[model samples]
Target: MIPHIHRRTFGTGSRPVLAIHCSLAHSGAWRGVGAALSDIATLHAYDLPNHGKSGDWDGQGVMHDTATDMALAVLDEIGPVDVIGHSFGATVALRLAIEHPMRICSTILFEPVYFAPLMADDPGFAGGYRHDTAAYDQALEAGDTAAAAKAFNSTWGDTAAWDTLPEASRTYMAERIHFVRDSAPFLMNDSADLLAPGRFAQATGPVLLMRGETSPWAEDLNGAIARRLPNVQEVSLPDLGHMAPITHPDRVATHVRSFWAAQGQGLRSARL
Candidate 1:
């Protein structure tokens, strides 16, 4: 049971919006965006099973199971919700909508990472993701916190600004890093080669696949996702990158609101 926690604020009768966080970040990461959404929604910001208040993450399968369990926990508490996810959380949101089509009104996925073919695989990118996962595990086990932090800073090595984060920030990211699969080797060994896009084709709701203008997708991952989804709404943030949702909360919120407004009754009438 990966314990999922949520922090929320909003009006009672407004549309319900649930924001799921990216890897490592907890519910607190949504504070800025949640506040924006609250103006027109009853927003709920979720914390991954072990990352925040809901600290127990023990679950059946691998990471996907943890994501599904967290979704169930959220639904149990609030009945149904309109979901929004960032990075890895986007992947979770898609999975939950597929597994529990009746529990979600709509979904917005911002650069979901579980899918790999979308990334113009440099072969190096895949190697790096796996390598860093292992390095972090090794550092954690050896109690070398600084090494762990340095490894983290380099994981997203391709990101132009990742390496520029101050040493203190890197240290902080390192100190707080949590890896259920130790390092990259474990990650590669434990997970599948790539997330199966077909798994989500049957989800009974509209999917808004978004990517930042300067994202590292190397190609049209958003378009690929759109092709796979039954009802897809695709958008690209013009003046932003992969971190746009965090850096530009107002824009992200506006995107969500606009997309929701455009959704016809067909989405609202879905099981969830």
Candidate 2:
């Protein structure tokens, strides 16, 4: 059984859109996107366990369990919803759509980081990802929390990003390094099942998969995901990286709203 998770609802529209943020982020991160779609969507964002205001999870910190927790929250508070998730959150959303297809009318994901597809297609790429991530993993092993956070963020985000962080932000991230460290292994290693043939075949929904053009490894990773989903439309944003949702929320919101608006037509007609 999943524990009760904390959620924040934005807008007053009757049509609901459940937003799940990436690792180390929270519901507040979805504010910009929520605001962008306020005219047509009631955004329901949740803080996954150990991320934001939500309490720490009691059991394992795996993606499937996290997805279940989010699903439970939807059942209790919002019922079925149009879903949007970013990075790790996107991975969870994909699982939920497959496991509970009836609950999601449409889905939008920003660089879901499952990595299984890349690994399967290119051994060298998989090895490089592990090597790059070793810096963060090693720091965790050596009990250098700040270094771990910096290394992990630098690889997926910006190289100088860590040093530029304000002291308070640095301290907070350092404090949460343990959660990041523990969760990283499950996300990176649990690819066998996630990449299983036809894993996404059962998920029936219109999916929008967006990735930043500057993202280092996303081309292959996101491409792999797009090929699997039955009805998926992939969009690439120029001059943006993996952190676009956080760094360039307004621009990202524009693209997202456009995609949602198009999908909303079928939903609106169904409602009437």
Give the number of the best model, judged by lDDT.
2
Every model's TM-score = 0.76, 0.90
TM-score winner: 2
Candidate 2 lDDT tens digits, 64-151: 5765566556755667777888888888788777767777778888998877666666778877876878988899899999898788
Across residues 1-272, which tens digit of lDDT does each residue of candidate 1 receive?
46535555544437777778776566776767777777677767767765556565563457556665666777788777788888767866876777677788899999876545443323456665555478766886798876765665455332445468777656545645654342222123324333455655657687888888777651355665566678888888886777666778788889887888888556666654
**Candidate 2 residue pairs in clash (backbone atoms < 3 Å):** none
Candidates in order have lDDT scores of 0.66, 0.76
* Backbone-clash count (model 2): 0
RMSD of 2: 2.4
The regions of model 2 sitting more than 4 angstroms off are 61-63, 184-186, 267-272
* C-alpha lDDT of candidate 1 relative to the true structure: 0.66
